[model samples]
Target: MKYDWVLFDADETLFHFDSFGGMKLMFERFGVNFTRDDYDAYQLVNKPLWVDYQDGKITADELKIIRFEGWATKLGITPFELNSAFLEAMADICTLLPGAKELLDALSGNAKLGIITNGFTELQAIRLERTGLSDYFEHVVISEEVGVAKPDLGIFDHAHQLMGLPCKTKILMVGDNPHSDVLGGINFGIETCWLNTQGVQTPAGIHPHYEVNSLEQLRMTLFA
Candidate 1:
């Protein structure tokens, strides 16, 4: 392996982040029939919170509780209760991306593995254990625990410190988001691979060291 430490982004990189589906399932438990229109309405409130979160304008707990504020009001529950319900729903539905298991299996011994996720601390541990992924990783650094999100230097710095500060060239960061994972790694002086699963054009002003269409392709690129 070319790298000593391999760090990954969680949602949409390793696990499927089916927010709509999870919301539907969660609302069903609360006796609400969630529709596509409902999802659109939800995103109007939810999406910006994520941007604010990654930008360090909001704390992880704030984003989690605030996103469900309207729903909590309607359901006669606290926002934290609704958020926990949604996360539980998400955990129940969590699955590895198609090639994620295979790639991790191959890298298990050859490279040290860790997760750097902007995802909620509540959801990550449950899903990792549920999916049998917990043992594969040496560390699971969470924004909620670290007090900083990705694309920020603080979270990456924390992960590096926990890693015993490996040489920048001997570490590789991989994720689906070009902005957070690719740009953050590049700025932090580590090698990076962007997992462009949807084949979208790279957004202007950011570039990753490598790009691949899928985890299988990433696996091949790393080991070929």
Candidate 2:
């Protein structure tokens, strides 16, 4: 393998993060039918919170509460309660992305692995354990736990420290987000692979060292 350590972004990179489905399941528990209109409305509030969280303008706690404020008020529940419910629902439905298992299996002995996720602490552990892929990773760094989201170098620095400070050239960060995973790794002086499953245009001047359409392609790129 070309790299000694490989770090990954969790949601949409390795796992299928079906937020709308999770919300629908969560709202069903509250006896509310969450419709597509409701999901669109929710995303209006939720998506920007993620951007803010990633940009370090807001903390994870703030993001969690603010995104659910409207829903909490409508449901007559606290945002904390609603957020917890949503995370649990997400965990219940969590599944690895296509080829995730195969890629991880192939990479296990060749390189040390870690996860650096902007996803909540409530869901990360359970999702890993449930997926039966927990043993492959040497470290799991969560933004909520680290108090810094991706695109900021702090979280990557923290992950590097946990990795015993591997050489920058010998490390690779992989994720679906061009802004966070690609830009962050580039800024941190490490190689990066953007999993551009949707074939979105690369952001201006934020180039990744590599790009692949899927984990299967990544597996081939790395080990073929």
Candidate 3:
């Protein structure tokens, strides 16, 4: 392996983060039928909160509560209660992406592994444990715990602290989001790989050291 430490982003990078499925399951418990239209409406609130979170404009707690506020009011529940239910539902449905286990197995002995995610603390631990991937990582830095989100150097710095301050050049970040994963890694002076599964155009002025369409491709590239 080219890097001594490999950091991964949790959602969509390693795990299948099916927000719609999670929400549907969560709402089902409350006797609400979550439809595609409901999901679209949820995303309208949720997506911008994620961007705001990555940009450090809002906190994870704020984002979590605010995104569910409308639903909470309608359901006669607290936002925190609704948010917790959603996370639990997400963890229940969590599954690794295709070839995620193979890729991790290939890289395990060669590099120190870590997860630096903007995902909530409520889901990360349980998801990893339930998916049987908990032991693969040396660190799991959550923005919620750090009070700082990705695309911000503080979270990366916190991760480095947990890593005992490894060499910057020997660290590589792999994630699905170009902005939070690639751009943040670039800004932090580390190598990065963007998992461009959708084959979307690379955003302006952001670049990754490598790009792959799937974890299988990444495994091939790394172990070739």
Candidate 4:
């Protein structure tokens, strides 16, 4: 393998995070029928909070509680409770993206594997365990635990320390987000690969060591 450590992002990069589907499922238990319009409206609130969370403007707890506040009030529950239910529903529905398991299996013994995700602490353990991918990673670094999100050097520094300070050249960070995953890794002096499954245009002022459309393509690139 070209890299000693292969660090992955949890959502989108490896796992299929169907947020709308998860929300719909969660709301079903509460006797609420969630619709696409409802999801669209929810995103108006939720998306900005995530951007703020990533930018260090708002905290994970703040993002979680605030996003669910409207729904919580309507349901006669706390925002934290709604957040927990949403995360639980997400974990229950979690699945590996196409070719993710195969790609990970191919690299399992050759490289040290780990995850560095901006996702919350609530979903990590259960999602990994349910998917039987918990043993594949050396550590799953969560921004919630680190008190810093991606695109910030602090979180990458924390991940590097947990990795026993591997050479920057020997580490690879892979994720779908250009700003957080690609730019952050580049700034932190490590190689990065953008998993551009959407085939979207790369934004200006950011670059990655590699870019692939799918995990199968990434596996091929690694061994090519």
Candidate 5:
């Protein structure tokens, strides 16, 4: 029952980022005026930049500017305008996942909590602050800040080092991704709990110490 630290994944775990809304707002804010088709194209082009950014192949700023530029060029808009609009829209639309506050409240004083996310520092910080979830974490490690992403042992090590917990066995990683969150924790020899909100079967060759259907399930599992 004794746990020294718990690390969480940010995007789907802590917050549900409305990427579609944010992108639509970005077009409106930038005055580019794109159609649904255009937005679809933009999403296709922009998603891979995040993977590259997480892999340390691109800088955070590069990923942002490139995503904006790619979408703008495809939509026949100026990249600079798109960039400004996207930043503004993204800042406004970022929000927390359902039951995030309640779960945080339940875990707050009971154990040390932190976040390990694969995202740009600016985007992650804006989301965390806007959602008021930043206060719950003792430490926050982002791939953009650390030059490494999840599923990479280095990021896990960085988080563990920052936590300064005496025992790795007492640390728990909770995340939605099988390859990233669960595999990453296993790689580092830390206990892992998969947040399988979608109820999907565990993928081949990966296993978590626990599986949770929802944040509420997590609360009950931890405190009940």
Candidate 6:
């Protein structure tokens, strides 16, 4: 089957979230004088806040503040200071995943590309623009801006509408997460491609139409 519009997930799909370079900058900026264990623990604590934020159970500002607050509290640091540092570090850190540019370039003219991410509009925009990938996409629908997150069929419907596609079947939703990306696409009747970078098994019940370990495989899978 041929797809006209290709929707993508931002963070782990196009870029690595655990960018060590970015983390180093963040550590220095925040003056976080903790051991590696602290950093690891902080990430463990902070990840669920993002899930909550995406699920619409928490506000954006609350998410921003709380993640740092939780981390700071655990490490006996001031939340305000950590929050300030985090914001600055986030703005300065821009790292693209492998094959990101190549994949975007390959698909640019061949299909209508769009970004459907469950992230803040400003941050996602900054990363995309910094990576010089903003031009490849026709539309970027971020959850915070849209007032809805993925796994919710509404956002999928909105993206489909924005693409001006006749139906969901004509579009391909590609991303790293099974719950958010794959299940969300399936919920909307769009063909789903699991960007299983880690080579994990397809979870118990969910099924993706296509499964690939890298974006580089996309061209061959879809066109060849």
Clash totals, every prediction: 0, 0, 0, 0, 1, 0
Error in Å for residue 141 of model 3: 0.2
Model 1 alpha-carbon drift over 4 Å, by segment: none
**Per-model lDDT:** 0.94, 0.94, 0.94, 0.96, 0.80, 0.79
- Alpha carbon deviation, residue 93, candidate 3 (Å): 0.9
- The digit string of per-residue lDDT tens for model 2 on 1-224 reads 99999899999999999999999999999999999999998899889989999999999889989999988998898999999999999999998999999999999999999999998999999999999988999999999999999989999999999999889999999999999999999999999999999998998998899999999999999987
Which tens-of-lDDT digit does each residue in 83-137 have in candidate 1? 9999999999998999999999999999999999999889998999999998999
Model 6 regions lying over 4 Å from their true place: 19-21, 70-84
Summarize candidate 3's per-residue lDDT along 77-184 as a digit string, tens digits.
999999999999999999999999999999999999999999989899899999999999999999999999888999999999899998999999999999999999
Candidate 4 lDDT by residue in tens digits, 94-210: 999999999999999999999999998999999998988989999899999999999999999999999999999999999999999999999999999999999999999888999
Decoy 1 TM-score against native: 0.99
* Candidate 4: regions farther than 4 A off: none
- Tens digits of per-residue lDDT for model 5 on 1-224? 45777889987898776777777887676566667887777778777876676566777667667777766677787765666566567779777667778888988888889999885565777777778776889999988778788888989989888987459888999999998899989999999999998999999999899999898888888876
Worst 10 residues of 4 by lDDT: 202-211
Quantify how close model 6 is to the true structure by its C-alpha RMSD in Å: 2.7
Q: What RMSD does each model have against the real structure?
A: 0.7, 0.7, 0.8, 0.6, 2.5, 2.7
- TM-score per candidate: 0.99, 0.98, 0.98, 0.99, 0.87, 0.87
Instruction: Tell me the spans in candidate 2 whose CA falls farther than 4 Å from its real position.
Output: none
